[model samples]
Each structure stands twice: as structure tokens, then as C-alpha cells.
Target: MDPLLILMLLAMGAFGGFAAGLLGIGGGMILVPFITMVLTARGVPETLVVHMAIATSLATIMFTSLSSVRAHHRHGAVLWRVVQLLAPGIVAGSMIGPWIGKQMDASTLAWFFGAFVAFSATQMLVNKKPAAARDLPGTGGMFAAGGLIGTLAGLVGAGGGFVSVPFMTWCGVRIHHAVATSAALGFPIALAGTVANVFYGWGEPGLPDYSLGFVYMPALLIIVAASVATAPLGARTAHKMPVRRLQKVFAVILYALAAYMFWRAA
Candidate 1:
């Protein structure tokens, strides 16, 4: 890789890691589009660029999630019981999601991602609260929700926070606790998604050199090194900051990214 490209990857990792920790996201939302652009600029085939970007983004999240989750765990905010309940379905859904994505045209996937990002941004901007408070659901409900979250996360290379956080808050969990638990959920989502991507893309033509299945190894390594170091810092900041305001700012950013994705798809 060029030295400049390496620098760009490092910068992206720093930003993504901070965002992941601060928002309880897996950072894939931030990473995917940027990585796609980089790969395209590097002459990677357009057919494979988006898939590689999504897979590499998920792979990087594996490290970022661990770093962020550790910080949340230290603060006693992670709901371990919830994680245990949701993880099985999350794993299953994530494993299946990449296969579904692989069947879609790249342009179609880009459009879907743009729409999903826009919807998530709108939800954050609205910040709607549930009309009535309710407790967490039973095992079956939780499993179903987890399946939905994992599937979407895998399809778009997100950390599932855009769905999970709101869902938990609606169930009467505190926002901070919801965020912390969402961070914990990211690990399974990313792990399963990455593994599935590898199998699904193996032996596919048009993939660039230094790729493991769909994942671009150089970018993943560079991003993970920086993201892991900075994620804890973001987690610490999240505890101290006013999260609602931050979420609004993040939503605005998402909206801009969504527009960019739409333009790229066009």
C-alpha cells in the first residue's frame, strides 16, 4: 500500500474507533463507505469493492468491539444476561446474512445501505421515546429481535446499535445500560459476519491481492491497530458526555454519509 493510503487508513481507524466507543456502534457504518472508496481508487474491481469493504469493516469491528466492551464492562454497564440471551440468534443471523448479501447486485446493496442509513439517522434525530414502559421480552422475543439486528448489521456492515439501542430503550432499559449492552452484542455480530464473509467470498474472482475471502487484510490490520488503541478513550468519554446531543451530531454525520452513498450508487 502507498504511504498516503496507510495514513488515510490510520485516520479512518482513529475516527471509527472513537465513534464506536462513544455510540456503542461497531464502527462498520463509518468504515464501509470510506473503505470502498479507497479500494476502488486502488483499482479494485467495482464488483468486489463493496463486498470487500463490508467484510473488512466487520473484521475491524471484531477488535474495536472487544476494546469498547471491556471499557463498558469495567463501568458495570453491560447487561450480561441480555447478551447471553441475544447472542445465539445474533450468531445465527449474522452467519446467514452475508450469503444473502452476496446474491445482491453491488448497486442494489449500495442503495439498500443508503436507505438504511437514512432511516437510522431519522430515528436518531427524532429521538422518540416509547409511550409506555415495559420490561425486556422473553427468550423467544429477544432471540427474534437479535436475529433481525444481526441480519441487518451483517448486510450493511453496522454494529447493530442503530437498532439495538432503540429497542432496548423502548423496553425501559436505561440509555447508558442499553448502549453498554449494545457494545457487548457487537462482538458476536462482527465475528459471525466476518466468518461468513470469508466462506461466502472464497474462490470468487475479482478480489484484490492480500485478501482473505472478502476481507482486505492490509486495511484490516492497519485499521485495527489504531482503532483498538482509541476505542477505550471514546468509551471513557461517553460516560462523561451528554449522549443525546452527541447522538444528534452523529445522526447528522450519518445523513451526509447516506447522501454520499446514494450519489455513489447513482
Candidate 2:
């Protein structure tokens, strides 16, 4: 990749990292479209662009999630109880997500990405309906939701925030705790996703050099370094302000990105 392009990706990484810190999101809404555009502009093979972006983005998230999770944990925002409650399901699902992804074609993965982005936009646009706390689902539902969301995250290279937040919120977890716990959930999402990308791409023919599975290492390096650099700032901001309002603003941004993804994928 060109040096200039690498620089731009680095910038995007910083911005995405900041957003992850501020919003408890994995920065997928920002990262994926930017990566797709970058790879497409460079005339990478049409079939490879989505796969590359998804894989590379997930690879970056492997680090970014840790940064944001740590930041949130430091602020006492992370709901460790919830993380524990969800861990078994999340781990089991996270493991399976990648295997299922290996069975999916690249284009199918892109479309899956598109639909999820659109769904996230729609969900973000809605008003909150606070459910009773007692209604929070137990082990079975946790496993089911975790597995499905994890698979989608692996397939699409997302941080799983788009699904995890709303699901937890609806399960009677408070909004603040839901977002905080979702930040932690990103860890499993990223780890599972990165691993899956490797499996799916493993032994496949004709991938770009320095790529394993769908990941492009040069881009991964730039994005992760920059994102981690800026995430703490975002985390501080989140702690000092009303994040729900921030989330609304971010949701509009997600809506726009969803539109862009539709246009590009079309």
C-alpha cells in the first residue's frame, strides 16, 4: 500500500479508536467503510476488498477492544458481573462464530455486513424501552444470543457492540451497564473474529502477501497503533458526559454509514 494511504488509515484508526472509547463500540461503523473504500480505490480485486477490510478491521479491534475495555474498566463503568454472566455463552459462541464464517463466501459476508449495519442504524434510531430488570434472560437465552451475535461479528468483522448493546439493554440491564458490559464483550468478538479470519483464509489461494486469512497486515499495524493511541481520550470523554446523548449523535452517523455501505455493496 502507498504511504499516503497508510497514513490515512492511521488517521481513521485514531478516529475509530476515539469513538470506541467514547461510545463503547468497536469502531466497526467507522473502520469497515473506510477500509472498503481504501482497498477499492487501490484497485484491489473486487472479491477481496470486503474480506480484506473485515479481516483487517477485526484484527485491529483485537487491540482496540482491549484498550477501550481497560479504559472503561478503570472508570468503574464495566459491569464485571454481567461479563461473567455472559462469558460462558460468549466464549462458546465466539468459538463457533468463526467456523461458521469459514463456510460463508466473501460476498455473502459483505451482504451480511450490510444488513447488520442497516439493522444497527435502525436500532440506534429507536427510542429506548426500559424493560423490567427481572426479565433479563438466563443461561439459555444468553448462549443463543451470544452465539448468533458472535457469528455475525465474525462474519462481518464487527465489534459486536451494535448487537450487544441493544440486546443487553432489552434484557433489563441498565443502559449504562449495558454499554459498559458491551465494551467488554468486544474482546470476545475481536478475538473470535481474528481467529476465524485466519481459519477461513488459511490455505486459501492467492491472498495478498503478508495476509493471513482476510487480514492485511500493513493496514492492521497502522490502524491498531493509531486507534489505541486515541481511545483513552474517548474513554475520558465518555466518563465526563452523558453517553446516551452521544450515542444518539453516533447513531445518526451509523445511519449514514449504513447508507454508504448499501451504495458501495450495491
Candidate 3:
């Protein structure tokens, strides 16, 4: 890869990592479209670009989530119990999601990604609280919710924070706690999703050089290195800032990205 391209990857990682720490997101939403654009520009087949981007994004999230979680843990914000409740279903759903994603055409996946992102952005902008505050759900309910989060995250190459944080907040968890917990949840989602993607794409044709199944190693390494360093910084910032305001800004960015994806898909 050109040194310029490497620098661009690093830049993307830095931005994504900062967002992850600040918002308790896995930064997959930010990474996926950018990675897809880059890969497509490099002459990768359209049919395979989105999968490779998503897989590589998930791979990077494994490291970014760990770094963000550690920072959140330092603040005693992570809810380990919630993580435990959600893990089993999240793992199961994540493992299956990439397999399903692989079967979709690139245009279809792009449309889905765009629509889902737009919805998330709307939710963030609305910032509507639930009509009635309730405690966290029963184990069965949590498991089912986790499954949904993991499956969506896997398909879109997200960290599951957009769904998890909002759901937790709606259930009466504090926003900070919800964000922190979402960071923890990202690890399992990314790990399982990445493993599934690797296996699912193994022996598939037309993958670019330096790929391990669907993952593009060069982009992964560069992004991970930059993201890990920046993630802690973002977490620190999150602790000092107004979270609601930050969320709104993040939502606006998501809307813009969604528009870009929609255009690309069309």
C-alpha cells in the first residue's frame, strides 16, 4: 500500500477510535463505509467490497472496544452484570450474522446499512426517553435483546452501541452507565462477528491480496494501531464533556454518512 493510503487509514482509525470512546460505540459505523470506499477505489469487486469492509471493521473493533472498555472501567462505569446477561445471545447472534450478510448482494447490504444508520441517527436526534421507566429486563428478555443487537451489529459492521446504549437508557439506566456497558458489549459482538466473517469468506473468490478470509490485514493493522492510542483519549474527553450534546453531533454525522451510502448503493 502507498504511504499516503496508510496515513489515510490511520486517520480514519483515529477518528473512529475517538468516537468509540466518546460515545461508547464500536466505531464500526464510521469505519465500514470509509473502508468500503477505499477498497472499492482500489479496484476490488463491488460484490466483495462491503463484506471485506465490514469484516475488517469488526476486526479493528476488537481492539478499539478493549481500549474503550478499559477506560470506562477505570471510571467504574461498566455494568459487568449487564454484560454477563447479554453475552450469550450476543455471541450466538453475532456468529450467525456475518454468514447471513455474506449471502446478500453488495447493493442490498449497502441499502440496509444506510437505512439502519439513518434510523439510529434519528433516534439519537430525537433523544426520546421511554414513557415509563423500568428496570433492566429479565434474563430471557435481555438475551433476546442482545441477540438483536449482535445480529444488527454484525450485519452492518457496527459495535452495537447505537442500539445497546439507547435500549439501556430507555430501560432506566443512566446514560453514562449505558454508554460504558455498551462499550463492554462491543467486544463480544466484534469478536464473534469477526470469527464468523473469516470462516464464512474463507476460500471465496475475488478477495484482494493480504486478506484473511474477508479481513484486509493492512487496513486492520494500521487502523488498530491508531485507534488503540486514540481511544483512551476519547474516553477521557467523554468523561469531561456533555454527553447529550455529543450524541447529537454524532447523529448528524451518521445522517451524512447514511446519505453517502444511499447514493453509493443507488
List per-prediction Cα lDDT, in the order shown: 0.90, 0.77, 0.90
Ranking by TM-score: 1, 3, 2
Q: Clash pairs of candidate 2? A: 201-213
Of candidates 2 and 1, the better by TM-score: 1
On a 0 to 100 scale, what is the lDDT of residue 149 in model 3? 91
TM-score of 1: 0.97
Compose the digit string of candidate 3's lDDT tens values, residues 167-202. 898888888888889999999999999999989999
In model 1, where do residues sit more than 4 Å from their true spots? none
Candidate 3 stretches greater than 4 Å from native: none
lDDT at 233 for candidate 3? 86
Comparing 1 and 2 on lDDT, the stronger one: 1
- 115-215 in candidate 2: lDDT tens per residue? 77777766766755546555667777777788777766766777777777777877777766676788788887787678767877776666777777778
What value of lDDT does candidate 1 attain over all alpha carbons? 0.90
Candidate 2 TM-score, C-alpha based: 0.89
